[model samples]
Target: MPDNGDLRGVESTPRRDAQVRVFAMPPSDNATPTQIVQGFLEALTSDDPQYKTARMYLTPRAAENWQPERSTTVLADGPDAAARAPVQDDDEHVAFTLTGREVATVDAQQAFSPSSGEYNKLLRLIRDAETRQWRIDIVPQGVVMGQSDFERNYMSVNKFYFASNTAGATRNEPPMAVADPVYVRSHVDPTTQMVRSLLAGPTTWLDPVVRSSFPTGTALAKGAGSLTPDDRGRLVVPLNGKAAEVGTGRCEEMAAQLLFTVRSPTPAVEEVELRSGDKELCSLAQESAEAVATRGSLHSPEYLYFLDEDQRAVRIAAGSDDTEPEPVPGALGEGEKQLRSVAVAWDEHTAAGVAVDGKSLYVGSLVSGGSLGEPVLRSTGKTEADRLTAPSWDARGGLWVADRNPAAPRLLLLEEGAGEPMEVRTPGLDGRIQSVRVAADGVRIALVVEKGDRRSLLIGRIERSRPDGGTAERSPVTVLELRSAAPELEQVTAMSWTGDSRLVVVGREKGGVEQMRYVEVDGSTPDIQQPAALTGVKAVTASPDDKVPLVAYSVDGIVRLPSASQWQKITKGTAPVYPG
Candidate 1:
C-alpha cells in the first residue's frame, strides 16, 4: 500500500483539440459606445490571458476592477442580438443589453453548473468629453460568451488524483487513477496550462473525494513560470521552496501524478521530474506510473450484460474472441417477469431491474439458483411514463432510479435491501428526468432530462451536507450545480459513463442522424476513435475503463465497438449494461 493519496482519473485522449479562433474585429481608432461594447463582448471569446485588448474598450477604472475569472455566463444563442437602448436624459450615456436563455455558468473558481432563465448582459457606456471616445462605464466583472464560441474557444483537461487505499480491500482493488475535468484555453500550450491547473489543486466538485500527492501550497519551483518537456520528451517541473519539505518517497508519488496528468496522445511526455530550484528531488517514467495508474477507471468489465429478445438477462464477452451469449444465473435469467431495463452491481453479485410495465423495480442475486425476488419498489404514478426508466447502482450498494411520471417526477435512491427510498432534490431543473446514472465516486449524477420537445444530458453534483448536530442523514440529499453535459446533442436518448470523467452517448445533432459518440462530463467531446455505425440505438453501455469494448442495443441487434472505426454484432439483446 502506498501512502500517497486518493486516486483520480484521466482519459488517454482529450475530447477536442481544435485551435480556438476568436473573430474579434480590432477596435477602430475612434469607437462609439455600441461598437466598444460589441468589441469587448467579442474579445471575451478569445484566448487572451489578460484581456489587454478588451480593456481598451473600458474606462481605466472599469478595466482595473474587471475580473474575467469572476464568472462565465453562457448564452443560448449568438451575441448578434444585442440591443442598444433608446437615448436617455444624458446623450453622453448609453446602454446595451444582450438577452438570451442562460444555459450554464462557471463561478470565479471555475466550477461549472447548468442555469436557465432570461440572461441579460447590461453595459452602461459614457462618452469621454476630452478624448472623444466612448468607454464602458458600468458592467459586470466576468465575460459572456455564446454557446458556439464556448465550444470552439475552450477545451476540457483532466487533472489526475489517486484513490484512497482502504483497509481490508481485495487483491484486485489496488489504488487507481481518477480524472477531474477542467476547461482551459484551447489555443494555449496545453502542456503548460494543464500542469499549472494541476498545481492549483482539484476543483470544488472533486475536492472531497480525491486527494493530491503534492504538499499543501506546493507550486512550480521559484523562477519557473511555465512547464515544458526537454529535448528527450521528459517534462521537468520545478517546484517552489515548499517542495523542499517532501521526502524521497513522497516526492516520487508526486512525480507519478505529474507524469500521468501531463502525458497525452499529443505532446506524448515520456517521463516527469520533480525539482526544487536546480536540484532534482524525484523522477518517474511513464511506464512506472502506469503500474499504479488507472488512466481513467479502475474496473474493466469483460462481459456486456443485457436482456435478450425473450426479456431474459444474459451475458456476452465484449471481444470477438468470445463465444455465444450465455444466460445469467439469477431469476432475471429465468425470465419469470418482463423487464424494461437492468443494472448489475459493482461486485456482480446482484442485479436491479425495472419491470416491462415500467412500474415496479426488482432486485435479485446473480449467483446460480438465485431467485428474482419481489419488486423492491413500485411507482405510485397514474401512467406508464411515470414508470422507472432504468436502475443504476453505486459503489456503496445504493440503487438509483427516476420516476418520469408527470404528476410526481423524481430521482430516488434505494439501499441494497428493502431500505426506505429517499427522494433527491433537484433545484432549477426545468424538465423531467428521463434516466439517471451515478458515477463510481458517488459524488456526480448523470441525468437525461426531457423538457418539452428537447431531451438534454445534464450532470448534477450530489450534495450530502450534515445537519446542525453533525449526525449522518439517511434521505437522498440535494443536487447542486446542475449543468449541461452534452449541450450540442439535439436529443440524448441514452448514455453510460465510459470513464471517470467520460460518457458514451447516443444522440443526434440538430438536423442530423442519431449516432454514438464520447463526451466529457463537462459537455466537451473528446477525440475518440469513432465507433462503428450504430442505428436505432435503444441503449448503450461501456465499462468505465477505455480499453473495454463499448456495447450497444440497436435496431438490428446487439453490437459492440471492437475498434474505433467499426461496430460488429454479437447477439440479439436490448438494454445492455455492465456491473456499475
Candidate 2:
C-alpha cells in the first residue's frame, strides 16, 4: 500500500478540503505486459465514465512529458492555478503532482489551467476505458523515465474517485468490473497500451455486473479465443487439442463452419510418390541403339541439297526413295555440249548457260557450234566475243548478259534469231558487271554494278523497246543503296530476288560480318532482317518456286527459306560454283 499521509497536507488546505485515497493490488507473478497495463487503466477511470469531462483534471505540463524510463513531475503552481485544479468540494479544490517515491502536494490557487484544445487532445491517451484500468498523464520530471532503457521500473500515477455522501471526497477504489482486458503492447509507454482478455479455460467466466447490465444469459455465451504471445514470445492458444487448430490446416473439417474466417486460410500440402515397390519406377538407363535410330529418323529430311548440275541432278533424284523431281524432257535445259555453268531461270523454260569460252551466251540450248540454233553472242559492235559473264534468258526469249567492258559496260537484251545484237543502255551504270538476275516478273532485272572500289546492286526495268526494234531500253533504278546499307563491300559477289520484289543482297558489312539484307523496291522502308551472321557467304540465289529461297554459300550449299535454317553440307571443300 502507498503512504496515504503524503497527500494529508492538500486535504487540509484552507480554500479546499481534500482527502487522498489509495488502493494497491498485488501484481500477478505470470501477468503479461498487456495485463499489467490493462489493470492499471481500469483502476484509474472506474469512477469517471465520460472521458471528455475526465480530461479536464489533467494538467498540460504532465501530458507533454513523454521520456521513457524517467519519472516526470508536474508542480501545479502559477496564476489561475485554482481553476485548473480538480474540484473536490463546493468551496474547495485539490492540486497534485507525482515526484520521486511520492505524489507531491500543491495549493489549488497555484495550479495552472491548460487550454480547451489541449484538454480535448488528451482524450486518446485513455486507450480503452473498459479494458485498461488506468488513465494517466505523466509529469515533466517523470517523462525522462519513459526515455530510459529501464522504463518498466517506474509506475504511472493514475487518479480515481469514489461516490460519497460528503460534498467533496477522494478515495481510490478498484472498479466493480474490468471488461475486455486487452492492451496495445508497446515498449515505449505502458499507460498507452490496449486491453484484451484471455480465456481462463475452455469456458468463459463473465462478470456479474456485465451479465446483469445486458440481457439474461448474454455473458454465459462462449467468446472467441484470441491469438496471443506466450512468455517466450511464441504465439500459442488458450485452448488445446482440435480447438487450437481453428485457423490451421488441421481444421479442414471445420472449414464450412468458419467460412467467414477464410481471409488467410492455411495452405494444403500435395504428396507425390517417386516409387512404389522395389522394382525401378523411374529408371535412368543408357538409350538403346534402336531408340536412337527412331529419334534420328523422326525428322523428314536430315539433309537437303540442290542438284544444280545436270549429272548431279540425275543422281540426287535416283538416290532418294522419297519424292523425286519429275523427269520432264523439255522441262529443264538438257543435252551435253561441255556445259560450264547453269543458272535456274525465274521462269521454267528459259535457263541460260555459259561454255568454257565464257563469251557466247547459250539460251535454252547447250549444243556446240550453234547446233540447235543461233546462240546469243556478246559483241561491242566491234567483234563477236566468246568470253562473257553469266547469261539469263527472259520470259520473252530475250537473252540478257552482263558484258565485261569498262568503256562500254553494257547489259545486253538480244533477240535469239535477230540479225545483229542490240545494246540495252542503263545510264549511271558504266562500271563492270559482276552478276545479274532477272526478276520473277520478267519485267525487271537486278544487276550488280561495280564502279572503281564501290559496288551497288541496282534493279533495272525494261522501260521501252529500241528504236531499231533490236533491244529493249534498260533504265537502272536504285533499290538498295549499298554505300548506305553496307559501306565496306569491296565487291558485291552475288545477288538474289526474294518474293514481293525484296532484293536479298549478300555482301560484307562494316565489321566484316557477312550480311544479307532484304530490301523492298515498292517504296517502303527496307527491313534489314539479317537471318544469320556468318562468314564467307559468297553466292545466294532464291528457288524458282519462290516458296523456298535457297541460299548457296561457298562452304555450305543450299540453305532453306522462311527461317533460313541450315541444310546438310553439300561439297566437302569450299569451291566457287564456276571455278577458274
Q: How accurate is candidate 2 locally (lDDT)?
A: 0.34
* TM-score (C-alpha) between model 1 and the true structure: 0.74
lDDT of each: 0.76, 0.34
* Model 1 residue 470 CA deviation in Å: 10
lDDT of 1 by residue, 343-442 (tens): 9887788888888889899898887887766788888777777778798987657888988888888888886645778887889888999989987666
Question: Cα RMSD (Å) between model 1 and the true structure?
Answer: 9.1
Compare the candidates by lDDT and give the number of the best one: 1
Query: Clash number for model 2?
Result: 49
